[model samples]
Target: MSQDSTVVCVVCGGPAGEPVYASDRECSITSLCEVVPSPTVVRFCQACGHVQTTEMPGIEAYYDTQYKILIESEEEDQLYAMSNGQKVYRLDHQARTLLRKLTPSAAARILDYGSAKGGTLKRLLAERGDLRVHLFDVSAMYLPFWKAFLDEGRWATYRPPAAWRGTFDIITSFFSLEHVARPREMMAEIASLLKPGGTFYGIVPNTFTNIADFVVIDHVNHFSAASLAFLLRASGFGNIDIDEHAHTSAFVVTATAAVQQGTVAGIPRSEIARLGSEVERIAAYWRNFSSCVREFEDGRTGRPAAIYGSGFYGTFIASCLSRPLDIRCFVDQNPFRQGRRLLDRPIIAPEALPEEIGTVYVGLNPVLARAEIAKVACWSGRRLDHFLP
Candidate 1:
């Protein structure tokens, strides 16, 4: 392209510097990345807050290959194991919560932009009998999950045929925003896909993720809330909002993007103490498990007393434990996960519990912890004392 037809920021049309690898883009019409080195590009719209991206040549083919290679039906086991692993579960919770916030009644028509296997859409539409959903994704495999939903009359799926730009009540993309080259244009596409004054829902990680996670893991850009909102406005979307877990806020967002100002924002902290306090609130609400964890010296053995429950709580607590109170083993119900090593310690199933471990810390959820303790004590035939009381 000539200098007269030169690229600008998609959102605000600012003079884009020629950064080596730019994520922001200028034009929504063209594919977003280009290889640049010397000037260092920063294409952003001043008025609309839109971001422009620089694309690498052949990026399109790469993304296509990634989608097919990843979501292929043949790799079901690998996908299932990784996709449903511990980390994804927590992230999924945020996605579900966002869907709920965006469309409360379930009576509206909804579309999940990158509907992988349609699991999230499936979960969102499960309760509301009035919901009608459509699935859109690059991979053809996602068709069946939505097909099942359609066949069950749970949702009606539609593939945007050539030149088919229909309006909808709501549109959503969970963890899929960073993958697009022209985020501004993609935002425009989303708006065009929605009816006038329609709602848009999205969830993106904070701009803290590494770029390698981008190149190798299907992400092209990492966006901050301010940048994202600016991009949306440039796309002709009037109301734009974005948020995420801040401070100790682990992984995931509690709500989706609502109409512009109505969207959630992460709790902001003005100072160090305030930030610490906010994180403490997050820990109390989401991360913390033990109300009070206390350890005592085992006078005779001197071999530090141990606790039970090998989940996140136990893992964290054990790591924080001091010299004399070092943990020896962990107990859990899931046989596959049990007998595993956590923090270099054995996570044994309760059946392996032995006598003389005497006092045990029940770090699991209270109700479930009690039941597990009962099973462990009964099955092991060991008179294990619990710390709950």
Candidate 2:
């Protein structure tokens, strides 16, 4: 990221002159903090309102350096546990939901472009069952983890059975477009990979959630639904639809039959700013309401005897349980998430739990938790008999 070079902003095609700053190295799995020299940071495009870094790391470099750190940071810190984790409804249900808006059979091969460990793909295949599935990510580390979720013969990748080229029905990227140096190129690649009538369904972060921070930090390209629609048309996608999923602060875009790249579409600059403000207002309200409903409790026990799981619902449950229970620890099974703290209380793995003082209030659907725990090899014959009327 030397100052002598110039790069184009992926969002607006503006020139980002030289990378100026770097991000702190982070590992998502262990939440370890290792301070590093700042990498180069870039500026925004005045024409299309795209902000990007001047130097885009190679995909290989991306995986080894910055990308791994970002991911490992989340895993180490149990970030998804801190925030409301994205939940997967069955893939069939997801496909059917989209089919209501998208042509069902028009999508033959489904690829989740930013499929992190294939959660979305699993849900899609879980529903459509017949579609050939492919999961793509810049990092190979997550592939093995995601593969466990796929049926033996159902999923493949870019390094696959050779017949997958240009044969997809739908390609999707959920919460993963803003980081790329050339999103349009990525889309074009996706388009080239798609059959003409094929659709590309994706989501990019807008001004939702902690996007303001993410924009300055993890993300390089942010898009309003309109701006993203314009990006799609430029990539030669038609029948483009922009839908806002407000809570995550993302725009879900569906484009069809992308044969020729179109031009960049954007509203007036003032409108983009106004859209940001409006979304911020809605976001503030959502946060306030969530705060009101989630109060940390003290159940007289020192440990987290209340709340649900260690992810989103767990955070809510624990945050709320803190209001009534003496939640000293948060429980989870993911080794990467154990030993951290949410709202200052320690997060502990189930294996790390000691004999409780008394009482356990479940948050992640009591029935589901009970069933899942029952399936655990160690707890198979155990009775959860701590709570009594």
Q: What is the C-alpha lDDT of each candidate?
A: 0.48, 0.53
Q: How high is each candidate's TM-score?
A: 0.49, 0.58
Cα deviation at 47, candidate 2, in Å, is 1.5
Mind giving the per-residue lDDT tens digits that candidate 2 earns over 171-260? 877767776656877887888878887888876656444333221334556565555766777788888878764223446678886565
Top candidate when judged by TM-score against the true structure: 2
The superposed Cα distance between candidate 2 and the true structure at residue 296, in angstroms, equals 20
Displacement of residue 85 (Cα, Å) in model 1 is 14
